[model samples]
Target: MTPTIPGFDYQRVQVAEGIALTTAVGGSGSPIVLLHGFPQTHLMWRDVATDLAADHTVICPDLRGYGASDKPADPDGTAYAKRTMAADIVTLARALGHERFALAGHDRGALVAFRAGLDHPTSISHLACLDVLPTLDMWQVMRGTNAAVGFHLYLMAQPSGLPEQMIAAAPDAFFGHFLDIWTHDPDAIPADIRAAYLDACRHAVPSIVADYRASARIDVDHDQADKDADNQLDMPVTVLQQDWGAALGFDARALWSAWAPKLAHTTVTCGHFMAEEAPAQITAELRKLVDR
Candidate 1:
Protein backbone atom coordinates (compact mmCIF):
# COMPACT_ATOMS: atom_id res chain seq x y z
CA MET A 1 0.00 0.00 0.00
CA THR A 2 1.14 3.55 -0.68
CA PRO A 3 1.90 5.60 2.43
CA THR A 4 0.17 8.93 2.98
CA ILE A 5 0.17 11.66 5.59
CA PRO A 6 -1.60 10.13 8.60
CA GLY A 7 -4.47 12.60 9.03
CA PHE A 8 -4.54 14.33 5.69
CA ASP A 9 -7.41 13.69 3.27
CA TYR A 10 -6.41 12.91 -0.29
CA GLN A 11 -8.40 14.05 -3.34
CA ARG A 12 -8.15 14.87 -7.03
CA VAL A 13 -8.53 18.54 -7.86
CA GLN A 14 -8.58 19.78 -11.45
CA VAL A 15 -6.04 22.55 -11.77
CA ALA A 16 -6.29 22.89 -15.53
CA GLU A 17 -8.25 21.46 -18.42
CA GLY A 18 -7.80 17.68 -18.43
CA ILE A 19 -5.22 17.86 -15.62
CA ALA A 20 -6.05 17.14 -12.01
CA LEU A 21 -3.49 17.00 -9.22
CA THR A 22 -3.46 14.34 -6.53
CA THR A 23 -3.61 16.50 -3.43
CA ALA A 24 -3.42 15.79 0.30
CA VAL A 25 -5.01 18.38 2.55
CA GLY A 26 -5.37 18.80 6.33
CA GLY A 27 -5.93 21.35 9.12
CA SER A 28 -8.23 24.42 8.86
CA GLY A 29 -7.15 28.01 9.39
CA SER A 30 -4.97 29.81 6.85
CA PRO A 31 -3.98 27.83 3.76
CA ILE A 32 -0.40 27.04 2.71
CA VAL A 33 0.62 24.80 -0.17
CA LEU A 34 3.78 22.70 -0.08
CA LEU A 35 5.35 21.40 -3.29
CA HIS A 36 7.75 18.46 -3.14
CA GLY A 37 11.04 18.14 -4.98
CA PHE A 38 12.24 15.83 -7.71
CA PRO A 39 12.40 12.05 -7.16
CA GLN A 40 9.92 12.38 -4.31
CA THR A 41 6.23 13.00 -3.82
CA HIS A 42 3.89 14.86 -1.48
CA LEU A 43 5.10 12.32 1.05
CA MET A 44 8.28 14.36 1.42
CA TRP A 45 6.19 16.98 3.23
CA ARG A 46 4.56 14.50 5.61
CA ASP A 47 6.20 15.61 8.83
CA VAL A 48 6.21 19.31 8.14
CA ALA A 49 2.67 19.31 6.79
CA THR A 50 1.34 17.40 9.79
CA ASP A 51 2.93 19.82 12.21
CA LEU A 52 1.86 22.97 10.34
CA ALA A 53 -1.65 21.60 9.96
CA ALA A 54 -2.10 22.29 13.64
CA ASP A 55 -3.26 25.85 12.91
CA HIS A 56 -2.99 26.29 9.17
CA THR A 57 -4.57 24.38 6.30
CA VAL A 58 -1.71 22.41 4.75
CA ILE A 59 -2.05 21.35 1.14
CA CYS A 60 0.53 19.07 -0.39
CA PRO A 61 0.32 17.92 -3.97
CA ASP A 62 2.28 15.70 -6.35
CA LEU A 63 3.46 18.06 -9.07
CA ARG A 64 2.08 17.60 -12.62
CA GLY A 65 4.73 15.08 -13.70
CA TYR A 66 5.63 13.58 -10.34
CA GLY A 67 4.06 11.09 -7.97
CA ALA A 68 0.35 10.37 -8.53
CA SER A 69 -0.36 13.55 -10.49
CA ASP A 70 -1.33 13.58 -14.15
CA LYS A 71 1.64 13.55 -16.52
CA PRO A 72 0.48 15.03 -19.81
CA ALA A 73 2.81 14.59 -22.77
CA ASP A 74 4.91 17.64 -23.60
CA PRO A 75 4.46 17.76 -27.38
CA ASP A 76 5.16 21.49 -27.58
CA GLY A 77 7.77 21.70 -24.75
CA THR A 78 5.77 24.42 -22.92
CA ALA A 79 3.67 21.82 -21.11
CA TYR A 80 6.22 21.24 -18.35
CA ALA A 81 7.74 24.69 -18.12
CA LYS A 82 7.87 26.25 -14.65
CA ARG A 83 5.55 28.99 -15.90
CA THR A 84 2.95 26.40 -16.85
CA MET A 85 3.43 24.30 -13.67
CA ALA A 86 3.27 27.44 -11.58
CA ALA A 87 -0.10 28.29 -13.10
CA ASP A 88 -1.33 24.84 -12.14
CA ILE A 89 -0.40 25.63 -8.54
CA VAL A 90 -2.19 28.97 -8.56
CA THR A 91 -5.30 27.34 -9.96
CA LEU A 92 -5.07 24.53 -7.41
CA ALA A 93 -5.13 27.00 -4.54
CA ARG A 94 -8.04 29.01 -5.98
CA ALA A 95 -10.01 25.84 -6.62
CA LEU A 96 -9.54 25.06 -2.95
CA GLY A 97 -11.00 28.52 -2.05
CA HIS A 98 -7.79 30.42 -1.49
CA GLU A 99 -7.10 33.46 -3.63
CA ARG A 100 -3.85 34.11 -1.78
CA PHE A 101 -1.73 31.91 0.46
CA ALA A 102 1.79 31.16 1.59
CA LEU A 103 3.76 28.98 -0.84
CA ALA A 104 6.84 26.87 -0.27
CA GLY A 105 8.68 24.31 -2.36
CA HIS A 106 11.81 22.18 -2.39
CA ASP A 107 14.07 21.35 -5.37
CA ARG A 108 12.03 21.30 -8.60
CA GLY A 109 9.04 22.53 -6.64
CA ALA A 110 11.12 25.53 -5.52
CA LEU A 111 11.55 26.50 -9.14
CA VAL A 112 7.78 26.36 -9.55
CA ALA A 113 7.19 28.39 -6.40
CA PHE A 114 9.72 30.98 -7.58
CA ARG A 115 7.87 31.36 -10.86
CA ALA A 116 4.52 31.57 -9.08
CA GLY A 117 5.76 34.42 -6.94
CA LEU A 118 6.88 36.27 -10.06
CA ASP A 119 3.86 35.52 -12.25
CA HIS A 120 1.19 35.61 -9.57
CA PRO A 121 2.58 38.02 -7.05
CA THR A 122 -0.77 39.05 -5.57
CA SER A 123 -1.92 35.47 -5.33
CA ILE A 124 1.01 34.40 -3.14
CA SER A 125 0.91 36.35 0.12
CA HIS A 126 4.28 35.06 1.24
CA LEU A 127 6.88 32.74 -0.28
CA ALA A 128 9.56 30.33 0.88
CA CYS A 129 11.96 28.40 -1.34
CA LEU A 130 14.11 25.54 -0.08
CA ASP A 131 17.52 24.59 -1.41
CA VAL A 132 17.32 25.87 -4.97
CA LEU A 133 18.37 28.95 -6.89
CA PRO A 134 16.11 30.45 -9.54
CA THR A 135 16.50 28.68 -12.90
CA LEU A 136 18.39 31.56 -14.52
CA ASP A 137 20.81 32.09 -11.62
CA MET A 138 21.24 28.34 -11.34
CA TRP A 139 22.53 28.11 -14.92
CA GLN A 140 24.66 31.21 -14.49
CA VAL A 141 26.53 29.91 -11.42
CA MET A 142 27.17 26.30 -12.43
CA ARG A 143 30.60 26.30 -14.14
CA GLY A 144 33.94 24.50 -14.34
CA THR A 145 34.43 21.30 -12.28
CA ASN A 146 31.79 22.31 -9.77
CA ALA A 147 29.19 22.09 -12.54
CA ALA A 148 29.73 18.35 -12.35
CA VAL A 149 27.42 18.35 -9.31
CA GLY A 150 24.50 18.98 -11.65
CA PHE A 151 25.23 16.28 -14.24
CA HIS A 152 21.62 15.10 -14.15
CA LEU A 153 20.49 18.63 -15.11
CA TYR A 154 22.66 18.56 -18.23
CA LEU A 155 21.66 15.01 -19.10
CA MET A 156 17.95 15.72 -18.83
CA ALA A 157 18.30 19.11 -20.54
CA GLN A 158 19.14 17.32 -23.78
CA PRO A 159 16.54 17.12 -26.56
CA SER A 160 13.67 14.69 -26.31
CA GLY A 161 14.58 11.08 -27.16
CA LEU A 162 18.06 10.58 -25.70
CA PRO A 163 17.54 11.74 -22.08
CA GLU A 164 14.24 9.88 -21.80
CA GLN A 165 15.68 6.65 -23.15
CA MET A 166 18.83 6.90 -21.04
CA ILE A 167 16.89 7.52 -17.85
CA ALA A 168 14.10 5.04 -18.63
CA ALA A 169 16.66 2.30 -19.26
CA ALA A 170 17.71 2.47 -15.60
CA PRO A 171 15.13 4.53 -13.80
CA ASP A 172 15.84 3.39 -10.29
CA ALA A 173 19.58 3.99 -10.56
CA PHE A 174 19.05 7.36 -12.23
CA PHE A 175 16.50 8.56 -9.69
CA GLY A 176 18.05 6.79 -6.71
CA HIS A 177 21.41 8.48 -7.19
CA PHE A 178 20.12 11.85 -5.91
CA LEU A 179 18.24 10.29 -2.98
CA ASP A 180 21.28 8.31 -1.92
CA ILE A 181 23.92 11.05 -2.12
CA TRP A 182 21.94 14.16 -1.16
CA THR A 183 20.77 13.06 2.25
CA HIS A 184 22.85 13.30 5.41
CA ASP A 185 20.61 10.98 7.43
CA PRO A 186 19.58 7.67 5.90
CA ASP A 187 16.97 7.07 8.57
CA ALA A 188 15.13 10.18 7.37
CA ILE A 189 14.05 8.40 4.17
CA PRO A 190 13.81 4.85 5.55
CA ALA A 191 13.43 1.84 3.23
CA ASP A 192 9.70 1.94 2.47
CA ILE A 193 9.56 5.62 1.59
CA ARG A 194 12.67 5.24 -0.54
CA ALA A 195 11.07 2.32 -2.38
CA ALA A 196 7.92 4.35 -3.05
CA TYR A 197 9.94 7.23 -4.49
CA LEU A 198 11.88 4.89 -6.73
CA ASP A 199 8.67 3.27 -7.92
CA ALA A 200 7.10 6.65 -8.74
CA CYS A 201 10.15 7.81 -10.71
CA ARG A 202 10.42 4.45 -12.47
CA HIS A 203 6.96 5.00 -13.93
CA ALA A 204 7.32 8.68 -14.85
CA VAL A 205 10.62 8.97 -16.67
CA PRO A 206 9.52 10.82 -19.82
CA SER A 207 7.44 13.57 -18.20
CA ILE A 208 10.11 14.05 -15.51
CA VAL A 209 12.72 14.56 -18.20
CA ALA A 210 10.44 17.03 -19.95
CA ASP A 211 10.24 19.04 -16.70
CA TYR A 212 14.02 19.34 -16.51
CA ARG A 213 14.29 19.99 -20.24
CA ALA A 214 11.90 22.93 -19.95
CA SER A 215 14.14 24.38 -17.24
CA ALA A 216 17.09 24.51 -19.67
CA ARG A 217 15.07 26.22 -22.39
CA ILE A 218 11.78 28.12 -21.92
CA ASP A 219 12.11 28.48 -18.13
CA VAL A 220 15.43 30.26 -18.61
CA ASP A 221 13.86 32.54 -21.20
CA HIS A 222 11.03 33.50 -18.84
CA ASP A 223 13.43 34.24 -16.01
CA GLN A 224 15.66 36.25 -18.32
CA ALA A 225 12.70 38.30 -19.53
CA ASP A 226 11.68 39.03 -15.94
CA LYS A 227 15.26 39.98 -15.09
CA ASP A 228 15.57 42.32 -18.06
CA ALA A 229 12.34 44.03 -17.04
CA ASP A 230 13.67 44.48 -13.46
CA ASN A 231 10.68 42.52 -12.21
CA GLN A 232 11.20 41.03 -8.74
CA LEU A 233 9.20 39.08 -6.22
CA ASP A 234 6.82 41.59 -4.58
CA MET A 235 6.14 39.53 -1.47
CA PRO A 236 8.26 38.67 1.56
CA VAL A 237 10.42 35.62 0.85
CA THR A 238 12.49 33.17 2.86
CA VAL A 239 15.20 30.95 1.38
CA LEU A 240 16.81 27.94 3.03
CA GLN A 241 19.73 26.30 1.29
CA GLN A 242 22.82 24.20 1.90
CA ASP A 243 26.09 26.15 1.51
CA TRP A 244 26.50 25.60 -2.21
CA GLY A 245 28.13 29.00 -2.61
CA ALA A 246 31.33 28.05 -0.78
CA ALA A 247 31.58 24.84 -2.75
CA LEU A 248 30.61 26.32 -6.12
CA GLY A 249 32.31 29.73 -5.68
CA PHE A 250 29.19 31.95 -6.05
CA ASP A 251 27.31 33.89 -3.40
CA ALA A 252 23.95 32.15 -3.09
CA ARG A 253 22.40 35.03 -1.13
CA ALA A 254 23.50 37.60 -3.69
CA LEU A 255 22.07 35.54 -6.51
CA TRP A 256 18.75 35.18 -4.70
CA SER A 257 18.65 38.85 -3.64
CA ALA A 258 18.78 39.95 -7.24
CA TRP A 259 15.26 38.60 -7.72
CA ALA A 260 13.74 38.73 -4.22
CA PRO A 261 14.14 42.13 -2.60
CA LYS A 262 12.35 41.18 0.61
CA LEU A 263 14.40 38.08 1.33
CA ALA A 264 15.82 36.21 4.29
CA HIS A 265 18.56 33.85 3.21
CA THR A 266 19.97 31.23 5.55
CA THR A 267 22.74 28.71 5.07
CA VAL A 268 21.53 25.42 6.48
CA THR A 269 23.81 22.81 8.01
CA CYS A 270 21.59 19.87 7.14
CA GLY A 271 21.84 18.08 3.79
CA HIS A 272 19.91 18.97 0.65
CA PHE A 273 16.84 17.06 1.83
CA MET A 274 16.54 19.36 4.79
CA ALA A 275 12.76 18.96 5.02
CA GLU A 276 13.13 15.24 5.75
CA GLU A 277 16.42 15.31 7.71
CA ALA A 278 15.49 18.30 9.85
CA PRO A 279 11.73 18.71 9.95
CA ALA A 280 11.75 20.74 13.15
CA GLN A 281 14.12 23.30 11.68
CA ILE A 282 12.22 23.37 8.40
CA THR A 283 8.90 23.78 10.21
CA ALA A 284 10.24 26.65 12.33
CA GLU A 285 11.63 28.45 9.31
CA LEU A 286 8.37 28.04 7.42
CA ARG A 287 6.29 29.24 10.35
CA LYS A 288 8.45 32.33 10.55
CA LEU A 289 8.08 32.87 6.83
CA VAL A 290 4.31 32.55 6.99
CA ASP A 291 4.18 35.04 9.83
CA ARG A 292 6.34 37.45 7.82
Candidate 2:
Protein backbone atom coordinates (compact mmCIF):
# COMPACT_ATOMS: atom_id res chain seq x y z
CA MET A 1 0.00 0.00 0.00
CA THR A 2 1.07 3.56 -0.65
CA PRO A 3 2.26 5.60 2.32
CA THR A 4 -0.05 8.50 3.18
CA ILE A 5 -0.51 11.24 5.74
CA PRO A 6 -2.62 9.81 8.57
CA GLY A 7 -5.99 11.54 9.04
CA PHE A 8 -5.78 13.41 5.75
CA ASP A 9 -8.53 12.73 3.22
CA TYR A 10 -7.23 12.15 -0.29
CA GLN A 11 -9.26 12.92 -3.37
CA ARG A 12 -8.96 14.09 -6.99
CA VAL A 13 -10.16 17.57 -7.81
CA GLN A 14 -10.39 18.91 -11.35
CA VAL A 15 -8.52 22.15 -11.70
CA ALA A 16 -8.55 22.41 -15.47
CA GLU A 17 -10.21 20.70 -18.39
CA GLY A 18 -9.26 17.03 -18.39
CA ILE A 19 -6.80 17.60 -15.52
CA ALA A 20 -7.41 16.68 -11.89
CA LEU A 21 -4.98 17.08 -9.00
CA THR A 22 -4.69 14.34 -6.38
CA THR A 23 -5.09 16.33 -3.17
CA ALA A 24 -4.76 15.46 0.51
CA VAL A 25 -6.84 17.67 2.78
CA GLY A 26 -7.21 17.69 6.57
CA GLY A 27 -8.19 19.98 9.43
CA SER A 28 -10.75 22.78 9.31
CA GLY A 29 -10.43 26.56 9.66
CA SER A 30 -8.59 28.95 7.35
CA PRO A 31 -7.17 27.16 4.30
CA ILE A 32 -3.51 26.80 3.34
CA VAL A 33 -2.34 24.92 0.24
CA LEU A 34 1.01 23.14 0.23
CA LEU A 35 2.74 22.15 -3.00
CA HIS A 36 5.39 19.42 -3.11
CA GLY A 37 8.72 19.60 -4.90
CA PHE A 38 10.35 17.44 -7.53
CA PRO A 39 10.85 13.66 -7.23
CA GLN A 40 8.24 13.64 -4.45
CA THR A 41 4.55 14.04 -3.81
CA HIS A 42 2.09 15.57 -1.41
CA LEU A 43 3.37 13.02 1.08
CA MET A 44 6.47 15.22 1.58
CA TRP A 45 4.18 17.60 3.46
CA ARG A 46 2.77 14.81 5.64
CA ASP A 47 4.22 15.91 8.97
CA VAL A 48 3.88 19.65 8.50
CA ALA A 49 0.36 19.30 7.16
CA THR A 50 -0.71 17.19 10.09
CA ASP A 51 0.74 19.66 12.56
CA LEU A 52 -0.94 22.63 10.90
CA ALA A 53 -4.18 20.68 10.70
CA ALA A 54 -4.62 21.26 14.41
CA ASP A 55 -5.98 24.68 13.51
CA HIS A 56 -5.83 25.38 9.77
CA THR A 57 -7.32 23.40 6.93
CA VAL A 58 -4.16 22.05 5.29
CA ILE A 59 -4.45 21.22 1.60
CA CYS A 60 -1.54 19.33 0.10
CA PRO A 61 -1.48 18.51 -3.58
CA ASP A 62 0.97 16.86 -5.90
CA LEU A 63 1.66 19.47 -8.56
CA ARG A 64 0.52 18.58 -12.06
CA GLY A 65 2.79 15.87 -13.54
CA TYR A 66 4.51 14.92 -10.27
CA GLY A 67 2.43 12.45 -8.26
CA ALA A 68 -0.98 10.93 -9.03
CA SER A 69 -2.00 14.26 -10.52
CA ASP A 70 -3.00 14.35 -14.17
CA LYS A 71 0.08 14.49 -16.44
CA PRO A 72 -1.08 15.93 -19.68
CA ALA A 73 1.45 15.71 -22.50
CA ASP A 74 3.42 18.89 -23.18
CA PRO A 75 3.02 19.06 -26.95
CA ASP A 76 3.44 22.84 -26.98
CA GLY A 77 5.87 23.06 -24.04
CA THR A 78 3.55 25.28 -22.03
CA ALA A 79 1.83 22.41 -20.24
CA TYR A 80 4.28 22.39 -17.36
CA ALA A 81 5.08 26.10 -17.27
CA LYS A 82 4.93 27.58 -13.76
CA ARG A 83 2.33 30.10 -14.92
CA THR A 84 0.14 27.27 -16.12
CA MET A 85 0.83 25.26 -12.95
CA ALA A 86 0.13 28.36 -10.84
CA ALA A 87 -3.24 28.79 -12.50
CA ASP A 88 -4.07 25.19 -11.73
CA ILE A 89 -3.39 25.97 -8.07
CA VAL A 90 -5.69 28.99 -8.12
CA THR A 91 -8.45 26.93 -9.68
CA LEU A 92 -7.82 24.06 -7.28
CA ALA A 93 -8.22 26.32 -4.25
CA ARG A 94 -11.40 27.84 -5.64
CA ALA A 95 -12.75 24.38 -6.39
CA LEU A 96 -12.13 23.44 -2.76
CA GLY A 97 -14.25 26.44 -1.65
CA HIS A 98 -11.37 28.80 -0.87
CA GLU A 99 -11.51 31.97 -2.86
CA ARG A 100 -8.23 32.90 -1.23
CA PHE A 101 -5.82 31.12 1.10
CA ALA A 102 -2.34 31.08 2.58
CA LEU A 103 0.18 29.29 0.34
CA ALA A 104 3.53 27.63 0.91
CA GLY A 105 5.76 25.46 -1.28
CA HIS A 106 9.17 23.82 -1.11
CA ASP A 107 11.72 23.41 -3.93
CA ARG A 108 9.96 23.08 -7.27
CA GLY A 109 6.70 23.84 -5.50
CA ALA A 110 8.28 27.06 -4.28
CA LEU A 111 8.72 28.09 -7.91
CA VAL A 112 5.03 27.50 -8.48
CA ALA A 113 4.06 29.41 -5.36
CA PHE A 114 6.22 32.33 -6.45
CA ARG A 115 4.51 32.44 -9.81
CA ALA A 116 1.11 32.15 -8.14
CA GLY A 117 1.85 35.11 -5.91
CA LEU A 118 2.86 37.17 -8.94
CA ASP A 119 0.00 36.05 -11.19
CA HIS A 120 -2.78 35.84 -8.66
CA PRO A 121 -1.87 38.42 -6.06
CA THR A 122 -5.30 38.69 -4.46
CA SER A 123 -5.89 34.94 -4.35
CA ILE A 124 -2.95 34.23 -2.03
CA SER A 125 -3.35 35.78 1.41
CA HIS A 126 0.12 34.89 2.69
CA LEU A 127 3.07 33.31 0.87
CA ALA A 128 5.94 31.17 2.08
CA CYS A 129 8.59 29.63 -0.15
CA LEU A 130 10.99 27.02 1.15
CA ASP A 131 14.50 26.38 -0.19
CA VAL A 132 14.31 27.67 -3.75
CA LEU A 133 15.21 30.83 -5.61
CA PRO A 134 12.97 32.30 -8.24
CA THR A 135 13.56 30.74 -11.68
CA LEU A 136 15.22 33.82 -13.17
CA ASP A 137 17.55 34.39 -10.21
CA MET A 138 18.25 30.69 -10.07
CA TRP A 139 19.56 30.65 -13.62
CA GLN A 140 21.42 33.89 -13.14
CA VAL A 141 23.39 32.67 -10.11
CA MET A 142 24.24 29.17 -11.32
CA ARG A 143 27.55 29.85 -13.15
CA GLY A 144 30.47 27.71 -14.36
CA THR A 145 31.56 25.05 -11.81
CA ASN A 146 28.88 26.07 -9.34
CA ALA A 147 26.23 25.10 -11.91
CA ALA A 148 27.53 21.54 -11.72
CA VAL A 149 25.59 21.13 -8.48
CA GLY A 150 22.37 21.37 -10.47
CA PHE A 151 23.40 19.13 -13.37
CA HIS A 152 19.98 17.54 -13.26
CA LEU A 153 18.43 20.93 -14.14
CA TYR A 154 20.54 21.25 -17.29
CA LEU A 155 19.91 17.61 -18.24
CA MET A 156 16.14 17.95 -17.96
CA ALA A 157 16.16 21.33 -19.68
CA GLN A 158 17.30 19.69 -22.89
CA PRO A 159 14.83 19.41 -25.75
CA SER A 160 12.19 16.71 -25.47
CA GLY A 161 13.30 13.14 -26.20
CA LEU A 162 16.79 12.79 -24.73
CA PRO A 163 16.21 13.82 -21.11
CA GLU A 164 13.01 11.80 -20.87
CA GLN A 165 14.64 8.69 -22.28
CA MET A 166 17.73 9.07 -20.09
CA ILE A 167 15.71 9.50 -16.91
CA ALA A 168 13.12 6.84 -17.78
CA ALA A 169 15.88 4.33 -18.46
CA ALA A 170 16.96 4.42 -14.80
CA PRO A 171 14.33 6.29 -12.85
CA ASP A 172 15.34 4.86 -9.49
CA ALA A 173 18.96 5.96 -9.71
CA PHE A 174 17.96 9.33 -11.13
CA PHE A 175 15.34 10.04 -8.48
CA GLY A 176 17.18 8.30 -5.67
CA HIS A 177 20.28 10.47 -6.16
CA PHE A 178 18.45 13.58 -4.95
CA LEU A 179 16.68 11.66 -2.18
CA ASP A 180 19.99 10.41 -0.86
CA ILE A 181 22.04 13.60 -1.09
CA TRP A 182 19.45 16.28 -0.35
CA THR A 183 18.48 15.26 3.17
CA HIS A 184 20.38 16.19 6.32
CA ASP A 185 18.77 13.49 8.47
CA PRO A 186 18.46 10.00 7.01
CA ASP A 187 15.67 9.05 9.39
CA ALA A 188 13.58 11.99 8.18
CA ILE A 189 12.70 9.96 5.11
CA PRO A 190 12.16 6.44 6.31
CA ALA A 191 12.46 3.57 3.87
CA ASP A 192 8.72 3.42 3.18
CA ILE A 193 8.33 7.10 2.35
CA ARG A 194 11.44 7.07 0.21
CA ALA A 195 10.14 4.05 -1.65
CA ALA A 196 6.82 5.81 -2.20
CA TYR A 197 8.60 8.87 -3.66
CA LEU A 198 10.77 6.69 -5.88
CA ASP A 199 7.79 4.72 -7.10
CA ALA A 200 5.93 7.90 -7.94
CA CYS A 201 8.91 9.29 -9.88
CA ARG A 202 9.45 5.99 -11.66
CA HIS A 203 5.99 6.21 -13.12
CA ALA A 204 6.14 9.89 -14.01
CA VAL A 205 9.50 10.43 -15.66
CA PRO A 206 8.34 12.21 -18.82
CA SER A 207 6.02 14.61 -17.06
CA ILE A 208 8.67 15.42 -14.47
CA VAL A 209 11.20 16.25 -17.15
CA ALA A 210 8.64 18.38 -18.90
CA ASP A 211 8.22 20.36 -15.71
CA TYR A 212 11.95 21.04 -15.43
CA ARG A 213 12.19 21.76 -19.13
CA ALA A 214 9.52 24.44 -18.84
CA SER A 215 11.53 26.15 -16.13
CA ALA A 216 14.54 26.47 -18.39
CA ARG A 217 12.53 27.99 -21.22
CA ILE A 218 9.03 29.39 -20.81
CA ASP A 219 9.17 29.86 -17.05
CA VAL A 220 12.22 32.06 -17.38
CA ASP A 221 10.48 34.12 -20.01
CA HIS A 222 7.50 34.59 -17.69
CA ASP A 223 9.69 35.61 -14.78
CA GLN A 224 11.69 37.97 -16.98
CA ALA A 225 8.50 39.63 -18.18
CA ASP A 226 7.33 40.14 -14.63
CA LYS A 227 10.72 41.55 -13.69
CA ASP A 228 10.59 43.91 -16.60
CA ALA A 229 7.09 45.01 -15.63
CA ASP A 230 8.19 45.64 -12.02
CA ASN A 231 5.64 43.14 -10.81
CA GLN A 232 6.19 41.88 -7.28
CA LEU A 233 4.57 39.48 -4.86
CA ASP A 234 2.03 41.78 -3.25
CA MET A 235 1.54 39.65 -0.13
CA PRO A 236 3.22 38.84 3.14
CA VAL A 237 6.09 36.54 2.12
CA THR A 238 8.37 34.32 4.17
CA VAL A 239 11.37 32.48 2.74
CA LEU A 240 13.22 29.63 4.44
CA GLN A 241 16.38 28.53 2.67
CA GLN A 242 19.68 26.88 3.40
CA ASP A 243 22.73 29.19 3.18
CA TRP A 244 23.17 28.15 -0.43
CA GLY A 245 24.00 31.72 -1.38
CA ALA A 246 27.22 31.74 0.63
CA ALA A 247 28.35 28.47 -0.92
CA LEU A 248 27.16 29.44 -4.39
CA GLY A 249 28.65 32.94 -4.10
CA PHE A 250 25.36 34.87 -4.25
CA ASP A 251 23.19 36.48 -1.62
CA ALA A 252 19.97 34.46 -1.36
CA ARG A 253 18.14 36.93 0.85
CA ALA A 254 19.06 39.90 -1.35
CA LEU A 255 17.93 38.08 -4.50
CA TRP A 256 14.60 37.21 -2.86
CA SER A 257 14.17 40.76 -1.59
CA ALA A 258 14.28 42.06 -5.15
CA TRP A 259 10.91 40.41 -5.75
CA ALA A 260 9.28 40.27 -2.33
CA PRO A 261 9.39 43.71 -0.68
CA LYS A 262 7.47 42.42 2.34
CA LEU A 263 9.79 39.47 2.88
CA ALA A 264 11.12 37.56 5.86
CA HIS A 265 14.10 35.50 4.75
CA THR A 266 15.89 33.04 7.01
CA THR A 267 18.89 30.81 6.48
CA VAL A 268 18.02 27.35 7.71
CA THR A 269 20.59 24.85 8.98
CA CYS A 270 18.70 21.86 7.63
CA GLY A 271 19.33 20.30 4.22
CA HIS A 272 17.41 20.90 1.03
CA PHE A 273 14.51 18.75 2.13
CA MET A 274 13.91 20.97 5.14
CA ALA A 275 10.24 20.02 5.35
CA GLU A 276 11.16 16.45 6.19
CA GLU A 277 14.55 17.11 7.81
CA ALA A 278 13.18 19.86 10.08
CA PRO A 279 9.43 19.57 10.31
CA ALA A 280 9.08 21.44 13.58
CA GLN A 281 11.07 24.37 12.28
CA ILE A 282 9.20 24.26 8.99
CA THR A 283 5.86 24.19 10.81
CA ALA A 284 6.77 27.14 13.02
CA GLU A 285 7.91 29.26 10.07
CA LEU A 286 4.72 28.46 8.17
CA ARG A 287 2.55 29.42 11.15
CA LYS A 288 4.40 32.70 11.44
CA LEU A 289 3.97 33.33 7.73
CA VAL A 290 0.20 32.84 7.98
CA ASP A 291 0.03 35.21 10.91
CA ARG A 292 2.04 37.78 8.98
TM-score of each: 0.99, 0.99
In candidate 2, which residue ranges exceed 4 Å CA deviation? none
| Least accurate 10 contiguous residues by lDDT in model 1 | 243-252
| Runs off by more than 4 Å, candidate 1 | none
Residue-wise lDDT of candidate 2 within 18-130, one digit each (tens)?
99999999999999999999778999999999999999999999999988899999999999999999999999999999999999999999999999999999999999999
- Which residue pairs show backbone clashes in model 2? none
Relative to the unseen true structure, what is the C-alpha lDDT of residue 14 in candidate 1, on a scale of 0 to 100? 99
Residue 110, candidate 1: C-alpha displacement in angstroms: 0.4
Among the numbered candidates, top lDDT falls to 1
lDDT of each: 0.95, 0.94
Worst 10 residues of 2 by lDDT: 179-188
Screening candidate 1 with a backbone cut-off below 3 angstroms (N, C-alpha, C), the clashing residue pairs are none
Q: What's the C-alpha lDDT at position 238 in model 1?
A: 97
Model 1 C-alpha lDDT per residue in residues 1-292, reported as the tens digit of each score: 8899999999999998999999999999999999999889999999999999999999999999999999999999999999999999999999999999999999999999999999999999999999999999999999998999999999999989999999999899988999989999989998889999999999899999999999999999999999999999989999999987888998999999999999999888988999999999999999999888
